[model samples]
Target: MKIKLSRIDDRLIHGQVATVWAKEAGAGRIIVVSQEVSEDDIRKTLVKQAAPPGIKVNIVDPEKAVKVYNNAKYADETVFYLFTNPMEVVTMIEAGIPIQSINIGGMQFKTGRTQVTKAVSVDETEVAAFRKLAEMGVELDLRVVATDPKGDFEGKLKEAGL
Candidate 1:
């Protein structure tokens, strides 16, 4: 399986992701690797429903995602991986998935999380996970849409003092 794009979007498969990002990635499949979402039948159904027409959507847990990635049955698949957090990305990488870079698309603000970019916010745990990803040599591309300029994720993390 080829990774066309790997993104961290809290909202998962929404308008921008179902349309813009998916199209930009040119992936035949969109795999949402989130343990929580995978366990929730309602969320899985909703996410699959939100996908663009003619494209397959799979909501799998981190372990299952790694299995799917290593499965020979999917060798010819081009996939766009949408993750909800940096920790899951770290999990995939640690599990032997060759994810080279990750796009920090949208991480909404919530209590205990500091806003880094307009579309991104992070708490201490998230910061640590992102730091680990960086240490692992994963290029962090911060952007909202495909047309938006890629912001400096490392610099933004520094500025936020995260």
Candidate 2:
């Protein structure tokens, strides 16, 4: 399956992602790669019910997502891969999933995370992962929505309206 973008947003299947990025990327399929939503078949079914029939929504576990993503399908259509959190992206990378870059749409401020932007919060470990991904030539973008796209947090956070 061809991927348009790997987006990390706390709210997996929401308005901004389903409509904004989906259209921007010209994506016909949405692969929701999350353990929480995929592990429970009930939630998976419910999310499918939430999707617009024209678009394909496959709520699969990360492992399955990677497997399907790497299966070597030569499709002309683009697929948007959505993850719930940064760790999911990190885990996918660690597990050999090829995510060139990721966009930070939204992440909840957890206990140790310092609020870096209006919608982004990063702790020590998360910062390290971000930096590591950056070092690995992955472009990490920071934008609350499609209209307000920004990125390169460690270096460009101050330049952008964080």
Candidate 3:
């Protein structure tokens, strides 16, 4: 799958993700993978309404995302995959989904989440999951804005005392 972007943004589907992100990335479709959004009929409808004027928003459960990931035939599709939390990716990886690179973008400010940089934060469990993902050959990165590129999350974790 030619995943344009894989992001961990807590809100899952928002305006920036719908319009600004889609336009800037030139993505044809967006897939927001989450356990909560996929199962909620109301939320799914609302997100679809909020999507960009032309592009499609595919709201799918993590399990179903596995199928989509495996079956997608669009080599240059420029589709994006997003999850509400980093742990969701961890869960998916443990379930045997293959992920390429991911960016930590919009997790909320929380206590004990030591700021590794402006965009990424971590405590203990997240660190463990990240480590496990790294062991599995999944590349992780941190980036704040569209213009700015990403940095290695493993190095950031080291600086954050992980």
Candidate 4:
């Protein structure tokens, strides 16, 4: 598969992702699949700037991303997919994108979200989507960076009484 790593991080293309995860995944391109970020010109530029030199960044909505993923054009490229939320990942999977594993990098705590970890948080809707992903046999690996010990994301959610 072209998707080397599928990660969910609120700070989409930040230092840790651009430097650490990208290097670990050996990805040639970083695809940020979020309609919100794709529409924001300033955010798009910022995310592009965060990418390491020589690496391409594509900020596109989920639908477009899935189409690109299914197309043969990027068959030779290694991609690290980034999403700010679980719903997007669910949408892609439901649309027939094959994602075997997902890394839960960061999800900042918002008003209605419950803290799952210092770097991860989720609300009811997110919890439901995550459960669905788990049910579909997608392994949810939780870790802040490549060096950190990976945690079983679904197990944590269950322990948190989701």
Candidate 5:
């Protein structure tokens, strides 16, 4: 499958992603590659239901995503990947999914997490995973929507003293 855009958003299939980012990426399919979400029937169902008309949604674990990506089963499909955290992105990448860049969209406020951008919050573990991804040549695009100016995610992490 061709990766149009990869994003780490806690709200997986929200308004901005369902409309703005999806349109910008021209994605035919949204692949929510998160083990936790995939196993949660209610969340998985809700995410699938939230997709824009004409776009397919696939909720799968990192392992299944890697297999589908490597097998070229969706070679003709333009896929936009969504993950909840940077660590899951790392997992998928290490499992052989060829992700070159990732959009740090939304990481909800939580205890012990430092706010990097207004919409992004990260903790020590996430910062480490993001650093690892950057070290592996993955560009991190920090943007809230298609209209927002993209910022440097790693730089923001550093600025936050991560």
Candidate 6:
């Protein structure tokens, strides 16, 4: 399978994603790689409904994603992967998925998380996961939208002293 874009956005299929990023990626399919969301029937339905017209959306757990990604049956499909956090990306890469880079879209602020950017927030565990991905040579491209200039995720991490 060809991966067009792998983005980390907690909101999953929203305005920016359903309209902008999917079109920008030129992907025929958008797969939401999240164990939590995949298991929730409501979320799966909602994500599917929110997908852009003429595009397909699949919500699969990380394990299923690995299998689906490596399957020869899907070799012709161009996919855009969406995730809620960095650790999910790490899981895929560690499972031999060969993800070269990931777009950091939005990681909304929560209690106990420090703001890394206007749209991104992270805690200790998230910081370590991001560091691990960097160590593994995965480029962390920070951009809120396709038109927005890419921000330096590494520099943001450093600035936050993460």
**Candidate with better TM-score, 2 vs 4:** 4
Candidate 2 lDDT over 1-162, as tens digits, reads 567888888677777876688776677888888989888888788777766558888888878877776776735657888887666777778788778979888877879767777777666676767777878777787776778847557664444322
Task: Give lDDT tens digits, candidate 1, residues 102-154.
Answer: 99999999999999989999999999999999999999999999998888898
- What is the lDDT of every predicted structure here? 0.95, 0.76, 0.76, 0.90, 0.90, 0.94
Count of steric clashes across candidates, in order: 0, 0, 0, 0, 0, 0
Provide the TM-score for each candidate, comma-separated: 0.98, 0.81, 0.78, 0.95, 0.96, 0.97
Per-residue lDDT of candidate 5, residues 65-118 (tens digit): 888887756778889999999999999888878899999889999899999988
Regions of candidate 3 where Cα sits further than 4 Å from its true position: 72-78, 94-97
- Could you give me the TM-score of model 6 versus the true structure? 0.97
- Which consecutive 10 residues in model 3 have the weakest lDDT in total? 69-78
Q: Which parts of model 1 have CA positions greater than 4 angstroms off?
A: none
Best-performing candidate as measured by TM-score: 1
Q: Write the per-residue lDDT of candidate 3 for residues 1-162, one digit (tens) a residue.
A: 566778877766676677566666577788888988888999889878878777878999888887776774755566778887777788778776667777777776589888877656676887887787788788876765666776778887787777
Per-residue lDDT tens digits for candidate 4, residues 1-162, read 478999999899888987889898888888999999999999999999888888889999999998898888778989989999989999999999999899999999989888888899999999999889989999889999998898978778877777
Ranking by lDDT: 1, 6, 4, 5, 3, 2
- Please state the error at residue 102 of candidate 1 in Å: 0.2
- Evaluate residue 59 in candidate 1 and report its C-alpha lDDT on the 0 to 100 scale: 95
**Candidate 6, residue 148: how far the Cα is off, in Å:** 1.6
Greater-TM-score candidate between 5 and 6: 6
Q: What TM-score does structure 1 among the candidates reach?
A: 0.98
Give stretches of model 5 more than 4 Å off.
none
